[model samples]
Target: MKVDPDFLDTLRLGGEFNARQCINCGTCTALCPLGMEIMPRKLFRYALLGNKEAVLKSTEPIYSCLLCKMCEANCPGGVHIAENVRALRSYLNAEVLEV
Candidate 1:
């Protein structure tokens, strides 16, 4: 997938999203009761690496985030995983989904 790494920074700079601080600890994915196949960690990496195709293809898991903040609470990096997931969903809404 084509990656535009700067897009991640744009997300943070353009919005209040804060996924850059993620430490890839997988706490979010672990606490996700849905047992999503790809989420939290992968999505964050895709976003950070600017993998637009992968990121867009991951719409389901992105939208699947329950906003429970379980991962955020356990995060040692203090990454707002839930908020970042919401931001990704919002970006998808405005750019890809356009809804």
Candidate 2:
């Protein structure tokens, strides 16, 4: 997908921050209780690729997040998944207000 440059920048800020350190071991996904339904790893991939449509369209799953921080706790890279999710939620909320 052709993601907008501005949106891509946001993704980089959130996704690239610790992406190089990620091992893609699936620990985060495994540790995430929500992974029973939603996949944080997939969300991370979409964020890394700057797929804004996918990310934003998946906002419902994002909102379903318990923000338990379990994923962050288990992340070997210390990627702060909860914070990224919160940031994305904030961005989406602001966008909705502007619409």
Candidate 3:
């Protein structure tokens, strides 16, 4: 699928999540009990590559996030996972729902 170059730009311009800061660490996925099949790392990777389809298709995982910050605590890269999830959720609301 073609990548949307403006996907990450839109996310960044929104100034909510910092997907660019992720270091591909698996800590976030591992810490999530509700995310066994879905991982934040994968989501962030999609966002970084401008894969809007992948991001959109991952609705179940995105909204499933508890925003518990367990991943944030375990993140060695210091990625703001909670904030990023919030931003992603907001993006989904605005883009998918056209809110």
How high is the lDDT of residue 82 in model 2?
75
Deviation of model 2 at 62, angstroms: 0.6
Residue-level lDDT tens digits of model 2 in 5-80: 5774664443333354566788877887766444577776776777777877787788888989887888888787
- For candidate 3, write residues 19-92 as lDDT tens digits: 66677768788889786555799989988899999999998888888888898898988888888888888888
Question: Which parts of model 3 are misplaced by more than 4 Å?
Answer: none
User: What's the CA RMSD of model 3 in angstroms?
Assistant: 1.4
Whole-structure CA lDDT of model 1: 0.78
List clash counts for every candidate, in order: 0, 0, 0
Which of the numbered candidates is closest to the native, going by highest TM-score? 3
The residue-by-residue lDDT of candidate 1 on 1-99, one tens digit each, is 687867876666536676667777777678778888576888788787888788888888888778887777888889877778878877888888779
What does candidate 1 score in Cα RMSD to the true structure?
Answer: 1.8
- Candidate 2, residue 21: Cα displacement in angstroms equals 3.2
Task: Write down the lDDT that model 3 would get.
Answer: 0.83
TM-scores for all candidates: the values are 0.85, 0.77, 0.89
1 or 3, greater by lDDT: 3
The better-scoring model by lDDT among 1 and 2 is 1
- Evaluated at residue 19, the lDDT of candidate 1 is 69
Angstrom error of the Cα, residue 89, model 1: value is 1.3
